[model samples]
Target chain A: MTTQTTAQAPARVRLTQLTRGQTARLDSADFKDDSAAHLTAMGLRPSCQLRVCKAGQPCIVHVDGHAGGCRIALSRDLAASLYVLPH
Target chain B: MPPVTLPTNPVSVTVAIRTAALVGNPNVGKSTLFNTLAGLRQKTANFPGTTQEAHLAQVQSPAGPIVLADLPGAYGLSLNTNESRICKGVLTGDQSIKGFPGGKPDAVAIVVDATNVPRNLRLAGEVIALGLPTIVVVTMTDAAARKGIKIDAEKFEAALGCPVVFASGKTGKGVADVLPALARAKVAAGPLSAAHIDEWADAVYAKACTAETRDHDAVTDRLDLAFTHPILGVATFAAIMTGLFWAIFSLATIPMDAIEAGFGWLAGLVSNTLPAGAIRDLLADGVIAGVGGTLVFLPQIVLLFFLIALLEQTGYLARAAFVIDRLLKPFGLPGHAFVPLLSGHACAIPAIMSARAIPDFRQRVATILAIPFMSCSARIPVYVLLTQILFPESTMLQAVAFTGCYVLGAAAGLFTAIIARRTILKGKSPAMALELPRYQWPSLLGATKTAAARGWLFVRKAGTVILAISVILWWLSAYPKPADPDDAQRAAEVSFLGRIGGAVQPVFAPMGADRQLTVGILASFAAREVFVSTMAVQIAGTDDAEGEGVRERLTEATRDDGTKVFTPATSWAMLVFFVLAIQCLPTLVVTAKEAGGWKWAALQAGWMTGVAYVAATIVYGVASAIG
Candidate 1:
């Protein structure tokens, strides 16, 4: 199920729903403290486009172009906490 | 107090030295920058409130030679871990927390990954708001250029209100410019609130760097697919670990043997030079041999660190951690424990020290506690002694038995950690977000420096503690000597250790250990390999075999009842006990320091001892029945 505030404003989808090879834009993350601060610091911010290189509870992501971009691993807990809009 | 206060001189204040701190996210080339700046002149010490050690160095700049403190990599001001919080305190100049010489940095070099502009800019914005003199060091420009992304430093600086330098540690490109930028660093006012900080970073990045482009990288994608394929990832991780150990064993054996021989020759010289007295014995047996025994494992430690540095440099470590995290998380051990756990095969001291990199408190402790059970290189000799006793001439049997010890030790480590995580060090396993740095050539000089530091700290910090315990053990075994002696065993029987061994013999009788074996076990508490030397003295008169090795004569050594000492059940039981036991006092000392206090150390020692005894007893019962 996908929820959208409006067509132009990005549809809301759980980050876990995005599989490997799928690119998505991060809308918001539902975290408060360490996890939130950590994710934000790692560049999983709203409006930032990221592609899933590998998907699982702990997903691997490459921001921007897959070649020269920063590749980071996120834990399942972090994955579930994120809200994304897939492209 | 009032009467004594009159003589107090004016408080002498030491002039504060200007210092810069290197701060950034992990795998963002922060360390490379630090190493490039500091070279081999770096010092590491634990920051207050956490086990994470801070690296400080003195690097020359045009402005002056400023002290550089490489603070732990962190995202923003505050985080859950004590490490990140300590970093926050350092940046905020919280006088209550100790980090730098002046309680805060004069300037901070924010090493940003150039490819991740927005994210790096986000951190840059937050730091700029702190009002510290800061410079944005854009690293990996060479790699960034390959993807058609160009970083305009002037535009970035103009927008962010600070200096920005496009540098690559790999190529040493624009590093000189960084020092000057750092010299002229000044905190530019940032957005007032967190919400606006994002907007500010987005706006600045838009003007400063090329727009984001999304496309598949065939090489990286193929590598990722191969490395992270669920089943293949596990297999790859295991294969890599096997390769690591194989390299450690094969590459380190030559140096290990040389160290052993060198120490033996030194001990021989000391023994011959001095008269046959307590002084000679103390110098040769107590001091040289005791210290040399622990130092013998240094080669393995250095090699392990060197290889781990290579793995981290290649970016495969992050993937390895991710793949293993799936297996570890269910056990309540986080993925990051892999480095410490893997390194434990070399030695536990370095393993415990490296556990500081783990961000989560309970997870780090769990890894620390579990490390000693990883069957380090020190336990190899003891394994050989027991295995040889059981399967005298069969090389295949000995090899098989050796492999079993490793498997059993790993199983024990995992089992104990799982139980501890669930029961004592109870906390939800925090999600770990590890950055996969771009694969590049591992820096040999940097790795060597790191290995040297770890080895130096091992000897300098834990060495004295081990030497002290060795001296005490030596004294206990040497004291209350009879006026004359015919055989070493007879001499030992009349000694203080002999009496103590007799007193404790009944406790170990179920494991088929005689009093002398009990004494060996007691001495082994200092270190595992010491058991072989001690057993040689108590079982046979000559502790040092020289030309004729102990291996040939050990099979013929017997107990007092004329019963053959190397019984199958007893050898296997002792082997099992040695496999599981916490025999290294130095490991305990390090754990005490690393795990915060002696409380956790005491628990670890007591529990491991208790478990080893029970497991050994069971092995003895079953083996005796089968035999």
Candidate 2:
């Protein structure tokens, strides 16, 4: 199932590859209840640009423009689930 | 019909003040705070159908009596996983799991870690939006201070328009003042204010917090360099795991030997004291020999739990999870599944229960099914016996082979998960959105306490369920004795159980398991250690020469053809088979209940058994061919 990449593609791709210091914009709808709810609760939305601040095995992404920039660690599976486009 | 005029009486009624549920992300020191308020006066019961316990305690407040329920530490009140669902249900009064059927808490104590204020506040903000009377308890203030971080607690409280408590659970500093304050606080019960947390992010920070410095970036950089390095991170994870396994094997031996010696002594004492009778035979053979045989390995199991608990408490487990997550992603499992899968190495019951962390139903089920494939501690005695018999000449090689069996079990679990995901459990792999709490030194006292408590529970279970089953098995093998006392050995060969074993012999013949082995297999279904005792009993009954002990009886036993029965190849195959098989009834029962019914459990057992049979058959066939 090939799908179009959103502006968050870079961030999502970096997450999938476990590459750090990359940024991307993710489509909110690409997320399921579990992922979406967690992301939304963590303040990561469709238009919000997130930076892959720390990506190793368990990657940490920094959601920019938030109070003191929220940092979240994304497991490889979660990184793959997110559809992102280059920001 | 006209209603008669009633006297207008203003009757005063006392309404019970509803509870305030404390919920938050993991490692926020919420549990410590909960324990402080609840003290030893708390009731610990499993959340319905789940192994996770719901701790309930009632505290008398000046306002009224208030119930304090400490829900599981969860990121959000969203039904992504089983734990989260339980948390959500408890928060919203969903009544999905009826253990907390008294409706939702009147208020919510959103515990936040002051050290990581941003991430913690995110969860706190979400809880506040749930329309519950929210009290934000900023825990770990001491830890934050140690890290050179400071926050204005009262300012944060005013910003959120909720009572905020700066409490240190470790020292009980500032903790005594929280409950009294909560009791006196007015119920701001109304629909939750529509606080768009994202929009007010900067405003909230400016109003609530004051950072001392930008020095955290340097620490973060160093951590990122070490932990997030592709090569270094993987190597560190491998080293950690190797150490874990090595510790499990080496540390367990001393205690395991002690337990075995104690049981052997008890067995000898019982046999010497009691006159030849059914009760003596039952006590010596069934209780002391059978149940005691199983208890001998309890130390190893407890040690394994101790190490795991230490790792978990120290926050190394989350790092391990992250490492495994990266590796397992290609295999269609989320990283969150790693802990559960790792837990499976010790036992599948807890592992299966721990699958509550996996959000997607398909992923969770896959993890659960795969758990039994991990070489659980229950299989250790069987494996040890077989391995000893097989590699009698080489202890080092035997140890290596034992380790190999564990690796093989893990491989099998992974293989099965892949197949199940592609076939029966087909679905998109769930996303793993997890919070990695900062690394902390593990509390030795806490780890010891947890390990002791868990070990005691296990001993209690063995005493009851395992003891009963062993007695029943003894009866099954002992009764309907052969007619001739002079030819007792031949009589046993013709008795009811002997006949049954003989009948089933052909089925396992290909696997090099004869009638005696068949009987051992039957006894193992009750408890795996019974395999050892059953063999001991069989050897004792067949030998005419007076043997001083069970070990000597076993060592001296010969097949009908005058050859040693415990051959290297046969023993190794048996060990391999037991290590892979799902034979424990209690495990099956737990699996059945966890899976929501008996049918799924049956299917799981059937598949595992089939796999064990085929694998054992192949091992035996190849070994015999090579020999």
**Could you tell me the TM-score of chain A in candidate 2?**
0.67
Error of 1 at B80 (Å): 1.7
Q: Per-prediction TM-score, please?
A: 0.89, 0.79
Model 1 chain A: ten consecutive residues of lowest lDDT = A63-72
Residues B1-627, model 1: lDDT tens digits: 111111112122222327888888777788888877777888886676556678888778877788888877777665565756766777777723243476677888888887777777666777777878877888877667776777777777777677778777666778888776777786677666677777777677666677455445767766776776688888998899899889888989899999989999999999888899889999888988888888888888888878887777787877777777877876678777887887888788888887876778898898888899999887888898889879877999999999999999888899889999989988777677877666667878777877888888877853678788888889888877766655687767878888899999999988888888899998888788888888888877778733246766677778888887778988888999999999989888889889888998999899888888999889989999998
Clashing pairs in 2: A6-A85, A7-A85, A8-A25, A8-A84, A8-A85, A9-A84, A9-A85, A10-A85, A10-A86
Instruction: Name the candidate that leads on DockQ.
Output: 1
Cα lDDT of model 2 by residue, A30-74, tens digit: 544456776765556556666676755456776643223445677
- Clashes counted in candidate 1 amount to 1
Highest-lDDT candidate: 1
